[model samples]
Target: MFCYKFPCGEFQTLTKMTETGITFDPPVYEQRYCAAIQILEDSRWSNQIKKVVEFGCAEMRFFQLMRRIEKIENIVLVDIDEPLLRKNSTSVDPLVSDYIRRREGPLSVQILQGSVADSSEELRDTDAVIALELIEHVYDDVLSKIPSNIFGFMQPKLVVFSTPNSDYNVIFTRFNPLLPNGFRHDDHKFEWTREEFKSWCLGIVEKYPNYMFSLMGVGNPPKDLESVGHVSQIALFVRKDFLEMQLENPLVTTPNLDDESTPYKLIHSVDYPFYVDTRTEKEKLWTEVQIELQRFKKMANLSENELDSYQETYKVPIGLILDRLHHVGATKEALLELLQENNLKIDDECVIIEDCDEESEGSDLYELSERLSQDVILTDQEHEEECWDLNQES
Candidate 1:
């Protein structure tokens, strides 16, 4: 998701130039997207792809574009930036919700906040992995590890990666004289020529003998130059072992979540069932409840006065308050019991749980339960312990 940003003055100048009909055309950006779709279309295994993971899914612009393809049931967007991840997650939630509500195929979207260089358990069992215009931003050491992580560790059936063609810098330098050396972006650590890209692909193929790759270029080069010297280069890797295994045991399936054999931690997830409208009032209430749960967890406790203050500040309707609490992991039975213990009438639809005794010393049972229910750390720890145990045994 990381990308170069021009300084304020330079950006303003660029903007002014563009507004005056002098555009800085980056053909590689659009061409890469087209190439990725075309590659998927050409693949014999395209229909078999139930899930696709996108590395460096900045702003999820490509995800929004690609999710329309009917064959993909799930898309996992991974990025290193948490704020961008959260923003994209918020942006896509309503779209996903609408898709689910309309029954337009089961399409699940997960926003993972993690590094692509690291082998993620969440990447396991996916059909394909995509990284477009991403590799040039990282140093050689990290770039070398990405292929192994994708092909050897995740072991997806297919991988589609694209990077800038350094050879095209000569053409680029013509457009902007300031970039004399022809670095596409200020943040790019290294851009590869066609031969360099091919060598790296060959190295990956050699490292994982079971996987093979194909190279292609996007965008048109000068009539004198070959297609390999185009604006962008793409590599698609297919796992031979996986294809053979699939043919042998066609009905065999991998777990959707991490299991004994696939011991990778599910670090972050946002799963939406194809029935809920996330824009509903109920959903808003649930969101508020979740926020309150986090705040209480951070403080480790909430005094009755603070609780009263929160209740007053955020005036949730009485009729749907209980239902909202239940939606956010508070058990209906426990809520009913709480009502009874306080000598309250459960049938009274107008009743809100606002009466907090000022003398009460402990966190509310509902808040405690909600906080405990979010066992993300515990789940990850258990996975790590299990992986360690398996390693020891091996």
Candidate 2:
């Protein structure tokens, strides 16, 4: 097999190789990488990406993912391998070369032959930049150049990138651990834990005054058990100007309780798996659900411990922003009515509901009926009974 130069300047041969002597062909990592790309496509960031550039995209997976959100107007694929670019001409994945070719008229695909270190000027004027599974391959001497070139030159609105969690590789690769810095992998110049990744990202963001960074851990346990706090880290770097403009009161408010069942309707209208894909992307939604539920509980003035049961029993507001979207400017009656309709009872200090206890089956309804009676609304017993029936049950 042809031994490729490692990022550490060492040459290593793969244990297994095809007749063509191609080493380091990992289909598993590739598929998981593609799954990460899929996760990005389903997130709120998808709406912001209209033009895309994939540095070391390797097989055009990120490009394909971007297209699912919107038609890509321009694409630039950069790699050091010219033969790969030539073969990309007929790559089964459309974005490689065929996508630009088949764009129905005068369109051109820009393929640059160079490494990211040498191609900073080329990474220009794009809506989003993706550097997936590319940083691991950069030689240590050239590593600093990677981010500086991209941020210093391109200044794209957003950047989505992923790298190996150092712990993941160490645990899986079983390299020396006693050393302060840990052992090096066969071909990796550096492997980073989530924290190291964040520090580097923060340093890069500091260099550019207009950028802000958010870190998202991308993978699940088996891949990274060390980062149990959050899963894999998926870093998102967005320009501060764009973020401020977008968040200028995104017009989100809490839901009104008594808007003719519309609040209930809207909440229920949310599709099952209120996220994208459950199979591979479940962890992303799980993190989102946890984060949002906490925000909702806080907005409702419920303690963290209270939400332990709340999240299990019912759909809690994912975040106050989302809650604001649901109830902003809503009348107090409408808000209270929605809470009651959902079997959620709110008091001055606590927002609560009966547990899934069989004994409390009709108790909330009975209490709600009494409150309505006191208000001189739903005075008819039969109508109250119907209202209970209409509102209760999922």
Candidate 3:
């Protein structure tokens, strides 16, 4: 996992700002946790997030979660406030940092002190844009600025926005009920009802003709539906063409259930790592073991092949291989045995079996593996002829 540059010193300086000496508000964490849960509820939705842009992220906790997503390429944090942005430059809460830090990668955090309209060139290509609890803060005079601020400028594939319902704002008054008529935000220009939000989203869709809008946390209710109110509506606006293609004729579905003609009928891969190795009978068993072991290596980012070798020598469970790797500490022995188990010919003296280029001899295994993974060049025919039995294919 890549690390976020969270300024510990700056957080120490801002510690006094916490009312109860807790730097992060529990409600903020709750909201973030809930959003993550919501994202996970829809597997397709969770998979769709690649590059993200978050607007009005006070401390960028939401963006931090975006960074955690497995395939995420970039995360851009945008906020109008300078201090809040500065805080994202460091630790927002010391206690929560460690738990969440390992999950975060190096985010492409860009702090812009203006609305989403003024986003930089890098932000315009974001795959998704999130504006949670921010639309209400726009002044009534600048209400039109909302669509003009985001539309072609951000050009996000999906837009997610949430705000409080004006009609159901009474409950939060005592806790935060200072606003007139029980509205959530004191400076909020307008609080929207369910219909009002849909209408607003429709207007946005009209402007961005390719967009499709739907209300989350509404029709498809969850188990804890009683606590949820109409006041808090989460809106998902996806590109209309994409939504139509996905919903109407999803290419990725259960395999051979009915339509056998579809190209991507299987929800998961059958012979994903390699296709050619699955066809032949002689190498089938060996290939299966190799594929599984390769998956383990890739997932764990193991530089040495010791775990692979140990797994082969002992014929142990995947867990045992992992344990031995951890116990023995990753060395060439572990990986070589794992590879040998998968039918690779191994000699005691030939532990360093990799046909290293003369240039990378002194380099570490990790660095060599990285280079080898990218170098797809076919080896010299003479080397292949001289190495071992031509029919071995080990």
Candidate 4:
């Protein structure tokens, strides 16, 4: 495994990997963020979500959970902590880089070092922006600029932010009598009450007519326990224009990244698994097609020259062929291309013998198919072979 070098000569590694990716923080703190991710994932406009920009993406634990949204292709992590961003970028240790390289699918993960409250060049293609458990950490001056920077300037379709509810800190005060200024973390400059948060959200939409707001809560206390509000209060701001545009036309899914310029610095970027496979797509599809053909040959007891015999050539329905291909994960679109390349017959439902020679007795469906295929076929039995204790093939 080769390691990527950084100018600082410091090594960074992504040692902690998990489905929920809760992070070093307490579960309740992380769970609030996780709930925000669930809300975005379950929202009606989720399928339209393609590119997302996450503000204050500390350690990128939340980004891992956000992958549940199937259509999300691009995730950009923006944080002012450049060293922390570099540490989580998998830019140093080979072991960590190998793990990141092995992550499956095509989601592009980018790390940027920049303050969220700046007049930075906007990533125009962003569908949604997430800023969970972030505002409380920002200084009051910087915090004031966020609504205008994110809602007015960046102008993504949706924005979801969560801040610790000061009202809910009574539950924490029971355990620790010295809960500092009713804030969950010492780093947090300030925490807000439910009403304060609601007022802030309303004021944002009033200033920027492009968006409308919704309020939700997460991490409710037990029913028997007294109500002190949720562990965190969430505000979801959706673009008013986006809702109006949907009424007149079908969703425009394709990204329009016309302004390629960006103020954010690229700290790291990684392409997940299957970006380049050892086998070409055609080769992989053809391998499955040949295996399915062999299975058909074996099951039917097809003779070498049986397809060339008299008026009726031995054959199976194209539908059945596709079904077998489906079992082995060959898509219909790929099958069409593979068949076209190999000169396979596709006449409605029937799959006829390819390059059939009427004069030659040796030309059968199995024989012709075997000759036509560019790959070697293994029996279905071999595919189902039990794994050995060691990695070596038996």
- Among all candidates shown, the one with the greatest lDDT: 4
- Tens digits of per-residue lDDT, candidate 4, 177-213, equal 6345546677888889998998888788777766777
Better of 1 and 2 by lDDT: 1
**Local accuracy of candidate 1 as per-residue lDDT tens digits, 108-168:** 7888777677765677788888899888878777776787577656777878888888887
* TM-score for each of the candidates: 0.55, 0.46, 0.51, 0.59
lDDT of 3 by residue, 91-192 (tens): 222222233223233333344554554434445556677787788887764566566545555556667788876544443342443456446556677788
Candidate No. with top TM-score: 4
User: Which RMSD does model 2 reach against the true structure?
Assistant: 20.8
Global lDDT of each model?
Answer: 0.61, 0.48, 0.48, 0.64
lDDT tens readout by residue for model 2, 1-394: 0111112232121223234422232333443454445534644455565556777855544443343333345566766666666565343233222322233222224555666665333455666777776787778767877765566556677777777666655443433343344434455667777778878887886666567776654334432243442223466676665654433222112222222211100000000111223443333332333333344433444654554544333334223323544423433454444446555555543444433432575443334434444434423543454334323321
Model 1: lDDT of residue 7:
19
lDDT of 3 at 57: 72
lDDT score for residue 168 of model 4: 68
Worst window of 10 by summed lDDT in candidate 3: 265-274
Candidate 3, position 80, lDDT: 67
- TM-score (C-alpha, index-matched) for candidate 3: 0.51
The RMSD (Cα, Å) of candidate 1 is: 16.5
